[model samples]
Target: MLGAVVAVNLLDAGYAPYRGLFAVNIALVLGLWLVLPWSRGHRGRRLASPAFLVATFALGLTGSAGTHVPLTLLAIANVAFVFGMRMAAAILAGQAALMSAIPLAVGRPMADVLREVGFLVVFAAFVLGMVASVLRARQLAERVRELTVAQERGRMAAEMHDSIGHHLTVIKMGLENAERFRDRRPEAAWDEVRQAKELTAAALADARRWVRALRPLALDGHLGSAALERLADSFSGTGVAVSFDVTGTERLLGPDTELVLYRVLQEGLTNALRHAGARFVRGSLAFEKGKVVLVVADDGKGHGQGRGFGLSSLAERVEALGGTLSSGNAARGFELRAELPA
Candidate 1:
């Protein structure tokens, strides 16, 4: 609307009064208004040619001084801002070359005409700087998004391994007991049957916990004492004396941070049960030196039969949160330690 008004006002001023040229300016504004809506949710492509911009500016120069003021700069600025520096510079260079040659071709000196091209070069540089800044910001934001998603996937995988793996280890131990007492010790076989029944109950509980942890809505919330309780309950039937302790004031952490810590603890406990073969598993959380420290230790025989997923998953999860995981023999058994930025 504003461009159309400017076009009409220029025509009314009656300077050079090219009615046909003003009509084209009005059509350009209307055409742009229609085109802009179709470019929604995407970058707009530059379509205005150097010839079009030069012709529009030359036409406006013949209007009244008031109309020429806005038109002269507007055309150059439009081409400079939209199509980029090189194209804008090319347009200015072409205009300068044409203006200088036209006067020379008619046997005249046009030295002052080339000076106008300098202004276009400056405008193009300014627009290029702005475009560069915007592109840099976009790249930084995209990198952050990719890292966030990767952390989330690592957290979910650790959660699945801890819950399911803990129960399966117990079931494997129970079946081993049943096999040892199957023939000669029928009476002892009855005890193994009872252990299998308990293992099955634990497995069912584990399945429920796995489903709950995997739920999208549940994962969004803070993994507070409630999540810790779930870990302790999962180990109840395994005959390991499991203890959980929290010493912090329970401030809320970032979503990704909380999930990572939860998985670290979960996997550590499962590792104690499966690899350490510990009779005592203890978990503690505390705030120390401006950091959150979580430790899971077991008084079990570390380095038992085979490789375990628990400790490996725990390390991956803790590292994802910019934390470290350290494990070794802690006097009587195995220990897993994690430290996360608070």
Candidate 2:
């Protein structure tokens, strides 16, 4: 649309001998615009390189004619808006130099040439500034979108850990208890087996809930203690006796902070039941003067050398929020602890 408007205005200004050249310049610009790939992907820029070359050729044609037409200005503005400010400025400077030299070489009066060059310079500056501002705004909007996506992914991960991990841990504990008591206490073993079956049914429901609520779940002023208690209750049928306690003044935490804390507890309890073969687990959340502290300890065999996938993920979550996480053998068992600033 812009190209057609500019071409008609330029043709109306009357350069009868250069009519064909003006038409060719317009064709080249239109062709470049048509062939340019405008997708938001890596290949878009690569594919658009040929269009840039076509734009350069169109600018050359406009300059060689030495007619007071705005074809070059149109090309420069389009390139700047599409490619970026730096490339646009470079093309503008080079085209200005070439256009100025053309009239001088033709023995046009110095004052007239200077006046034309001055007008081109002012116009190019205005176009460059406008294009630069637009590019900056585009970049900022893209960054915001990226951040929003990353945050959503983090939230879903936390929710998945809390929901799925709790159910799986309960099922595992139930099976383990059933196997251990089958020979000595058949009735108790049967009860554990029944509990495991119920947990599997509940797990299916929880899975749907997590899927339906992909958005971040708020603490709703409960902080994280209510969720922790629910997690502790799921382990009831298992031999593992789990306990949860909260200390210090309970205050609202940022969503990210609460998520990290919840995940740390979930992952810790999961590792305790699944890997450590722990019969007893104790978890605590303490809100201190300037920070919150979480500890999950299990009376099971401690880690020998390296961390597992769950611990690695937990560590990353804690560290990203400017917190510290440590896991090692305590006096009698394995312990995972995280401290985060409130």
Stretches of model 2 off by over 4 angstroms after superposition: 1-14, 24-28, 35-69, 204-342
Q: Which ten residues in a row have the lowest lDDT in candidate 1?
A: 36-45
lDDT of 1 by residue, 56-101 (tens): 5554453433344234344555555556556556765675576567
What tens digits encode model 2's per-residue C-alpha lDDT throughout 178-228?
A: 999999999999999999999897787656544433423333444467766
Q: Which stretches of candidate 1 lie over 4 Å from their true place?
A: 1-17, 20-24, 33-111, 184-342
For every model shown, what is its TM-score relative to the native structure?
A: 0.42, 0.50
Among all candidates shown, the one with the greatest lDDT: 2
lDDT of 1: 0.63
Question: What's the C-alpha lDDT at position 87 in model 2?
Answer: 74
